[model samples]
Target: MHYESPVREPLVIGDKTYHDITRDVARPIETTAPKMWWIAFSIAMAMFLWGVGGILWTIANGIGSWGLNKTVGWAWDITNFVWWVGIGHAGTLISAVLLLFRQKWRMSINRSAEAMTIFSVIQAALFPVIHMGRVWLAYFVLPIPNQFGSLWVNFNSPLLWDVFALSTYLSVSTVFWYVGLIPDFAMIRDRAVNPIQKHIYKILSFGWGGKVKHWQRFEEVSLVLAGLATPLVLSVHTIVSMDFATSVIPGWHTTIFPPYFVAGAIFSGFAMVQTLLIITRKLFNLEDYITIQHIEMMNIIIMLTGSIVGVAYITELFIAWYSGVEYEQYAFLNRATGPYWWAYWSMMTCNVFSPQFMWSKKLRTNLIFTFIISIVVNIGMWFERFVIIVTSLHRDYLPSSWSMFSPTAVDIAFFLGSIGFFFVLFLLYARTFPVIAQAELKTILKSSGEKHKKHHSDDNHGHH
Candidate 1:
């Protein structure tokens, strides 16, 4: 007599097998491009071109081409810079922090999340260079010794720390992303029928072969990198927050900034992940692999981080009022009722109020509502940065210097263009690579599918 294995809920549905995982994940890469892919790619390219035009015009005419003025020198450019950087944080959290915690569900999404991290950081890095006005001499921020007086970067300055932090984050993320792709690249190399495709994948795979030793080394290396990246996921944003916190500006100076910024980063980053994955799962017919369960789990994270961000908002208000510092008090009061009141309220509504919907299971699980709220969360996060930067800078202690900032056509173009750039990279990645981790998914097959359990039972009975 044979005993049955206990039934479990499937993470990868549609009764998928290990072979099915490989075929489904690799199909997008090996097959011809779909019409929708081309249409999307075309739109992204157009936006990228517009961004290029904006950058070139700025370089030619100087920073004056932007809406920046004396009262608000750091306007749209820095706001966009911080927004992109924050958006990258969710990828690191999903990949590194989740991995450390032994979360198996992350295997399906970590590949694309890491890719998003690298691309978003690239977009974030652009703003600082272009904002320099004299783009060629931007390297002056580095600590390299120079002929003129052996000038060195300021160690105590947060701005200098940003240069180092960003560079380090980009380098580590790129290496981590590429290392994870090697196994999948080898799988693709084995599957390729065309000589050119086979050769390309061979180089990309770095001669990876599925030996026991190779698998052992892969696991060890992944664990080590994940450990390293976990701290960075926290530190990078903390340093970014320091850019504001260290400043004497009333609205910007606060003790709650480090944790607050980190929470907001994860909030925005998860929203972006949802926005991309919802479209991807639909377009690629990957409903079985990237299931509703995955979507719901991500929404839960967004809700958690969104709540933390909301608390940070209220804390800032309370701290300002409690301190009785007139400057700090006015900063909070002005944020809610000043000329930029609309932006502030928009941030409050989207970040604080919208996420409250997730308390209902029905709303969290509903795809359309989740998608819409995810977008709203990102918009709110962006406005949160804008409000922090602009409102803090626009008004001075000497009321005579108080002024408002309005974005120019170039500023608008660059911001919209950056969105296009991000999407363009993502679309290309979806078509050219395994968006899901096929090998990792195979490892969990026995635990996730009825077919795997039945197969295991048959093998056990035969041995008996």
Candidate 2:
């Protein structure tokens, strides 16, 4: 029943077999850590420790440790939150949305993308919690009963909706991720020579024996979850957009925010995925499994989303000018020409202009160019959030309140620390977990694997 068009390139290159797939995937976990892994881990660990120090400093010193001023109340914290959250969007899109569409290419990269989603969402969640200053009072954001005179969370607040949206997204994504891991865990369990390893994977695998019923249920649950998660990929970021759109602030208030934010999220999320997958393929020597076809496929998505983001940018400017509201127009103008103009232009160059290069088939398919563009797109995304959040708030209605914002060392540390922490989690996951879904990849081996394609071609040549 498995069929792939002959014109389509093979997904799994280099004549890989099922056994080879399992061995290559399990190698990192079974073998001793390579020196490069150790070196990378040490660097990431150092960065994470430095970030931890910054978090501790903030906790000890309060919000005063940041560079937030009266005019710019929300700065790096919100920017980073949105950026991380945006990055988190790609995982579910890759896993859930693509699954619903029955895209087989997802099988290779979906595992790591899901991990990235969970880890990045964790990083995004940290900012709002830390921004609370009184971290103990963070529980108040939740609706649980407290001793504070029966006070409840405000239902109207978009922030509360974020709590619901982000938590739901995380829960579903985690379940979806773990469910996919079960069969792979069982693979490792069966392969384990060490009793302790076997015992651990046994529990992790949940007694999966590759029964027909097991697969049937797995497919059912995955379809159900994908259906559930598909809406989330859109809803979560839409609610996030409401955080800005609901506000009455000039640049902040707009109907375009929801779609704009969602597109930007996908744009940046794919870029991060590209960054992670490229590095992963290099480090793990998974070039055959994670092929150029996969890279080109991802690049196509990046290009599409990046174009959508660019259009959103222009739409925002048009709306600002067309709205006839002086403040709104001024906000957009200031973004490009004000003190923060550099950030705005950086966003433009990175986000708006860079992805245009993907139009070239040669460039999008080229590994090195793709990697560079991926980093560029992420940088642009960060700047985009900064421009949107800061530029809007820095200038108020009254001239007296207008002031520029700057980040203190603590602010920089927290941002760098989050990056460190993200990589720390990803590195550990890459080493321990099956970074690629071997079970799923096996299903498509006959249809899209290189060996099968070679055979098909040879048969056609013989008939000719």
Candidate 3:
């Protein structure tokens, strides 16, 4: 018997054209029936509200509301700061590194990921700003030559470097993301159902008519932006790592941190991508575009980067022992056997052991399993940062300095609130813009048709 084709609807090949494909997918990652728009709008608004509420509470109270003490000064705040920053790295990586390598997959996800990078960085920025007991004087972190006092923002401070590095990264990444949106925004502007959306898109598009010269110039600027962003991604994480690595803190000091942190940034960043996209594709009804193949590909990256992170963990443990530095060795030992040993082990289990399961082909293809693993990876990475920061600092050299840290109610609430913030922003994004990159999707469709034609022609040649 002839094998039945798996194909259902035979999409009108080339009839849609590259421009048509880009126009449709540019609205949302998935298409909603006219009836579904209300549901999408309501959900997005609710999440945004919760996020706002959480931030307000943080401002009204103080950092004292967190799980911090004099002995254990860092806790969830710093862990989350690093985690969000790491998540931001994936944005630039997808847009920048992939462009340099000429990878097309970057096209499909880069817009959303870049937006994710900007929003996550915003969330990450909130921590350092509000973590200051005097949130009113956040300007103190900025290095403006002030005549107000002798207090110059110390050039020698890594915190100051972080201020410069993060500001530059945020500004550049935001511009890059917005610039890429121009053509797509033009599509939305033309197809817009109402005057409001049309006006918004018109302004955003800045008057593009999809001219060839426009695409040409757009591509050139995108390339330059990608080049700038590649270093920006590497530098931001390295600088964040240096905030600790440059320190006298035993577990925090090591040359391994820069690259190690970059790898971890990519790992956690991908996990957040998977988490958001998995839900996004479903909600928007764009299964054909996102595809099971896409998730599998991401799973492979998650496993690879996660393994790199695991190796970093093992290397740190080995180096701690080999270096024969009592402080470093003791820090590692304390992580494994001390008061927060559970946190340490939980991190290893989630980040190291859980993602290793993706090595099995069967599991990688299982969406439910991959989703669970994504959550596990996120949790593991968060705890990894927490354990690194808290365990080493809680017990300094002297016993008199040793103390345990636990997050208070406010800390727990604020952490939970930021998740709401991220999702809220993402939910709004899903509604306002296309969840899937339409322009990028057109490239894949072109590639797919070419593959099918090639195979069909080969079959005829073999028969001849």
Candidate 4:
């Protein structure tokens, strides 16, 4: 029953045994820090500290330190917020949705993808909190008792919905990720040589006994969580799109936003996964586990989502023109031809045209080409958010209310600092956690492993 087609490339190459997997995954954690890890860690730490300094500067100086005028109030912070949230979408999709559909390919990459989701969502959560001029008053966004004077939260607002949606997402994703890590934690617990290490992992593993009933319950719980999480994969991004779709802004007011945002989120999310996994496999020497097949599978997703995003872009333009609404048409036109036209074209070229390169089988499988394209796609996705937020607001119906927007040094700092912060978390996770879900990977070895497949073929030949 466990037979993979001959045409299907092996998921795990190098004829790896189960022991080899445990050894490879544990090596980075058990061994002393490698030179490259230190180099990468030092650079990431510097970036994180710089960003922390920027965050402190903003807190001290107030929102005035940021580049916000009356007309273009929501700029870089909101843009980055949406961008980070979009990046988190791929993790849930890979873990929850793929799990529901019974995709075995997810086994190798889900751990890192889920970690990326949790970290990126952390970054996303920070923006809205900081965007509030008084971070102390952030509790006002939540619905609390009337004892606190009259700071009632508006139930109708998408902003309020964002608070609810994002929190739920972060909570569910964290739980899902941790639940899946239990068995892996137990594996490390058993392997730990040091008493302290053993005690730490033993507690983390929750005294998992690997009993028949324990595994039975584990499988049921994973399925239940996956089922619960599957809808969130769609709902989270749909709600995120509502932040714009529910708006009256010309470019922002569109029915297509929910699906459009969802697709764009997956598009950018997959690209980020590619970016991280490429570096991870190389750094950890996990080529046998995270293979070209994995890379190609991810690329194929990036292409599909990228193409959907391209169509959405075209649909937006056509809708703007066809709606006979001058304001809508002007919004799209200004994006392509106004002061921030560079941003618009960058989005187009990077999000739309760059992914088209993946149409070639040779290119999608090419690691260097995939890495470069991955970066390009993320850059394009960032520009896409910028153009949408900045362009739509810069020129409104009333000429007197119209004004341009630019970022202060603080704006740049917060953005770059977030990147550093994200990597700092991921690098730590890479070192400490099993980057690949080794337990789940073992399930696929008999069917999709190169050596196992050859053995099965020989047995068939002998029988015949």
Q: TM-score, each model?
A: 0.96, 0.98, 0.90, 0.98
Per-residue C-alpha lDDT of model 2 across residues 376-430, encoded as one tens digit per residue:
9999999999999999999999989999999999999899999999999999999
Ranking by lDDT: 2, 4, 1, 3
* Alpha-carbon RMSD to native, per candidate: 3.0, 1.2, 4.6, 1.3
Q: On a 0 to 100 scale, what is the lDDT of residue 223 in model 2? A: 95
Winner on TM-score (2 vs 3): 2
Candidate 3 C-alpha lDDT tens digits along 214-317? 88887899899999889889999999999999999999999999999999999999888888778776765555556666677788989999999999999999
* Deviation (Å) of 217 in candidate 1: 1.0
lDDT of each: 0.90, 0.93, 0.80, 0.92
Model 3 quality (TM-score) = 0.90
Question: Candidate 1, which ten residues in sequence have the lowest lDDT sum?
Answer: 1-10
Q: How many backbone clashes does candidate 2 have?
A: 0
**Per-residue lDDT over 1-464 for candidate 1, one digit per residue giving the tens place of the 0 to 100 score:** 22334353457777786778889999999888888889999999999889989999999998999998889989899999999999999888988899999887788888888888989999999998999999999889989888789678899999999998899999998888888899999999999999999999999999999899999999899899999999988889999999999999999999899999999999999999998899899888888888888888999999899999999999999999999999999999999999999999999999989998998899988999999999999999999999999999899888899999999999988998898899899999999888998887788777765576666667878998
RMSD of 3: 4.6
As a whole number from 0 to 100, the lDDT of residue 207 in candidate 2 is 93
Clashes of 1: 0
Please name the candidate that would achieve the greatest lDDT relative to the true structure: 2
Candidate 3 C-alpha error for residue 338, in Å: 1.0
Give the per-residue lDDT of model 4 (tens digit) for 1-464: 67777667788998789999888988878888778888988888888888788788888889899999989988999999999999999999999899989888999999999999999999999898998978877888889976668768998998888888999999999999998898888899999999998999899999877899988888898899999988887888899889899989999999999999999999999999999999999998889999999999999999999999999999999999999999999999999998889999999999999999999999999999999999999999999899989999999889999899989989988988899899999999999888998888988888988899888878878997
Superposition error at 51 for model 2 (Å): 1.0
Clash totals for all models, in order? 0, 0, 6, 0
Better model by lDDT: candidate 1 vs candidate 4:
4
